[model samples]
Target: MLPRGPRAFSQAAATALRPPSGSAPERLCVAELPGSELAYFAEGGGGGDGGRPPRGFLPPPGRCFSFCVPSGPSAGERVRAARLHRRAEQRLSREPFGPGGAAEVLPLLAYAGPSGSRPEKGFLVRDRRRLPETERALEDLVRLILPPPARLLSVYEAAAAEDGGGGPLWRSLWRLQGAPESKVLLGRARVAGAAEPALHPAAPHLLDGAAVFASFEAARASLRECLSVIPEAKAVLDLVDGCPVHAKKGDFPVIVIEGLDATGKTTVTHALKDSLNAVLLRSPPPCVSQWRKVFDDEPTLIRRAFYALTNYIVASEIAEQSTKSPVIVDRFWHSTAAYAIATEISGKIQHLPPVHHPVYRWPGDLLKPDLVLLLTVSPEERIRRLQGRGIEKTREEAELEANNIFRQKVEESYLRMENPACQPVDASPSREEVLKTVHHLIKKQCHFP
Candidate 1:
């Protein structure tokens, strides 16, 4: 028997003392009292049995008392039992234990623990009020934990602070994580704090909308920088692996002349190709050249797809040759866009797909030409030129000829293109005069003597 409350004998002792098997034991018995409480007694000990009655039976002590409450908790027992369980939980929640049921308490421990003492110890704390202390701890921990290559803790800290308001200590820690060096840190910080979320911008010089385009440009610049860091031959080989355009081993200054028919492109390209010692390669090139036939026989979506596919093949060939020789292309990607846009203007098509659509690709990734000369001629002049060429009209050609309106729209679209690579030349003058101006521009623009 034991005193009640904290000193009470545990239920294990009582269970051990009970006989293992019995109907009720004849000498010693345990029973429930009135309100479902337990009582224990020795029955025949007073009988003075000279023989030992039961080997395991010990004489009951005087004034034996109850140990635990008799009844197990009933369904109706709510408040009292719940209060006890909650108290136990609260006590356990304050300590640090290994992962499992105890791991959940770590965040709370972090919040409640002492401030700024053990820097590593304080980092787990997430409370806003405790952030100052936590930040200081993180900085110290970073120095201890991070190797040189991985030490961007300061940079992270600075970036976080710029993005949203936090404690000064927290911001300092972020800078340690986010930006270790000044130049790299500042650039990242600005990018992180920019109005728009972009990795790169189209034009770094144009601050007004630069942020809008930065995401793409930043990624491109990063890739380029990474490539530059590698050995040149290795980088080129890697580029070839990723882009089919680099498969050929040739060094040529490839000039691709692109425009609608009767834009004086053929005349200018022949002259330019001769002057530059370039090969005049035309799209729908001899090999895999079905698009030209499609254009002549069946002008439909299928034809468009064929034309776009052949152009890519030709572009790839040009890119390969560009390694060694100067290659001139009569028409390239610009013609693709012009024709697609023209189809749309005629109300024959709506919503042209993006440049990378399987049917067509934007030539943006193609090898950049040293120069692109765009011949600009008025609708009337173009019409006259077409008539003078004495070429049989296709359906598209007839449509453009019948409605000067369509021709004007196509011309306007071409002029409005935003690529910096193209230089427009007026084709109203005689072919010879126009070619001379073009030759002069090329000499100046491309540094040709």
Candidate 2:
């Protein structure tokens, strides 16, 4: 349901909330949202008594669409953003993109230009299995997502003056090939040059280098750039280089346990270390832990390289120690790539580089673990654990709660790798029980004595 209130009600908002005029999803999923959030779905004309969204409304794909929520209700706006984002996630999980299938949907948040005019947003329907099926789906999606530019224009006053309002700000759409260069052109607002209204084909300058490292050398250059901003990060970089790469692969197995904060990964890892008589090592090894937080605050490229470099450092440790006994690791490249990929993109999972994409592939230079045990827990349980721990949450931990899409993508990306795929372990069980289960898996897989 859209929000209800005389001020909030509008024909454009209502129309946009529904599946565009002619296209309707095969099925509509209805979930029980809290009564407090009812206002968001209730806003606009014809929500009637129940305040539900109009029938035929398939929850918009995992992208936020403008005109979905009526403007000016700050509290309602926040609540609706959360709900719509969740809805988008729901749709994406249900309909994953396969080979030749399009994975992303774009919901442009159009706003009034200088003089005021409408704009558009869209998505492509695709399937690797059938061309006709793909075409039909794409058409339905395009029609269903008919963005109400007029409604966005109606609410465009506050931001217009600052950005320099004009007419339809842009008219362009980029092909979403599911790659590093992919982009979604949301509605453009007014800008500096009013004499000519040209389309902005590129994504925002801030996102230029999001979640990417063209090569190790590129990563090094970018790392140096970040270090220049924070002198302390340079020290960490030096310390990582201080540890020489191991000359030979270890005789014993190296196992890595990874999961979000409060998922018992730390506890399980230490226990496994003792049980397996294994040496415990962490990425951003103890030598560099001092600056882990420092680099964590820096932008994506630098932060990832810091973690990536730590893996090489730990690889050195693993190679040396596994000669004597097994090596147990707390985190590794999976953490680095997953968080990087998730943070770099917005909206649906489809927007992310698909599974098996090169960006998701493990780095060639870094040593691969004998087995990577990835821990998983439900969102409700993960939150409960975080609250119980009472420690200051890391930025990543905080984001896990703040953005559902980001959190989901991180876990998905972690499990998507193939060079050394992550084996999912349910961490929701008792710590002792989880350890026992993982022990069985480790012993069976590693043939550990």
Candidate 3:
């Protein structure tokens, strides 16, 4: 059993897991905070009349987050009897319940244990009297911190902190209330395309079958459903209808260039096009590209479906282009799937769908690339290029700079892609050198002169 008190508690929490990455200073958990039960279940358990939780209290505890790592009395059995003993010295540092004052909050983390509680993590924000301002601030923070797929409706309320201060601790209400229906659909699986049955329905990104669309037909169905609500989807649907079900590579090779932003994809693809006299194409295929931002702002279902269909349209283009000369694509289904999978799952690289999970398999009906090259640069070099470009970064691009884990997941997704997995190329050198290396690979792989 873990020891109690401020010093021992701090050491135990620190040792329970590795300190979080990034350069943030270490802050210890409050001593009296104890664990999950003390923080959440004490003080009549938020009940008033008839022992029932108040209205607006999130229900079905499965959806709620657990706060503490199992330890001490809660170590071996259920922690129902443990109670927090509040001391005057252990009260929270501040209690900002002023009409319009901001309150201090802390981000919390808990380990998954054998007792079946999943690992839980999130921020605890103070509830405010000004509802509108509080809502807007929380929305902004959610957008900044979480990817679209992971965002959920939050619950805010007043509660008694274990220290006897009537401080509030809030958590996001997830999966049901305000989340997109597609989110529920996405998480229904074990992992996109996993053959094993999904035992845990509430698992966040451990989705089964497909993350976005399992097949082209599935993508078409989602597009058709969103036509009335998302008008821009009509263009995508029309492009899908006209495009062939499968695009067979023409007489020549179809080469695709892929990487994170500022990895010199534009420079290298253009150079390759010029050298090989290849027809260059990009997905959403210029026709639907104009509406890229519109769909990007939509839910993951609409966003990913739009991009997936664009790959089919590009496939048709590839068939035609390759017949005349070798084809070069700026980005294809690889970029679409890599970014989607990375954004859908959070935390470390290990949290990603297992290696060669069906999520990484190429769609059978879509045109497969003869060769896909992933451009890689040293982190310093990548940052240096981003600074030199002087263009605004996309949300994911900005995240790449701030979060190493997200960036690693994206690149790793590319590597794990099956069938026509990407071959990593060191792009840290000059543009000419990178292009030279790509040309050599294409010649050897495609037998192109």
Q: Which candidate ranks first by TM-score, i.e. highest?
A: 3
What is the lDDT, from 0 to 100, of the residue 174 in candidate 1? 23
Candidate 2 residues lying further than 4 Å off, grouped into runs, are: 1-216, 245-247
> What alpha-carbon RMSD in Å does predicted model 1 have with respect to the real structure?
33.1
What is the per-residue lDDT of model 3 for residues 1-449, given as tens digits with 9 covering 90 to 100?
A: 22322234334333341223442221111111212111222111122123223222222111122123222222111111011101100122233312334533433333222233433333444443333444444444444334454454334333333465432322223332243232221111000101111221112322221234557886776567666666887877886899887778888889999988888998998888898888888766778757877876564445677788888888998988787899889988888888778765544466567776777888888888899999999888888878867776656678789878778879998999988999999998887888889989997899553
Q: Estimate each model's TM-score.
A: 0.40, 0.56, 0.60
For candidate 3, give the lDDT: 0.56
Candidate 1 local lDDT, 161-189, one digit each (tens)? 22343311101112233342221221111
Give the range where candidate 3 is weakest over 10 consecutive residues by summed lDDT.
185-194
Q: Top model by lDDT, which number?
A: 3
Give the candidates in order of TM-score, highest first. 3, 2, 1
> Roughly what TM-score does model 2 have, to 2 decimal places?
0.56
Which scores greater on lDDT, model 1 or model 2? 2
Pitting candidate 2 against candidate 3, the one with the higher TM-score is 3
Residue 414 CA displacement from its true place in model 1, Å:
1.9
Candidate 2 lDDT over 1-449, as tens digits, reads 22232223232233332323343211111111222110112112222234322221222211112223222223232223323333333343444433334443323322233233221121222222323343333333323332333112111111112234321111112222232323343322211111111222111211223334433444454455554357875776686667665335577888999888878888899898889888998875888767877766654445666676677777778878978899899998888778877765444465556566667666766677889998999999888877766676667768789878778878888888777899999998888889999999997889554
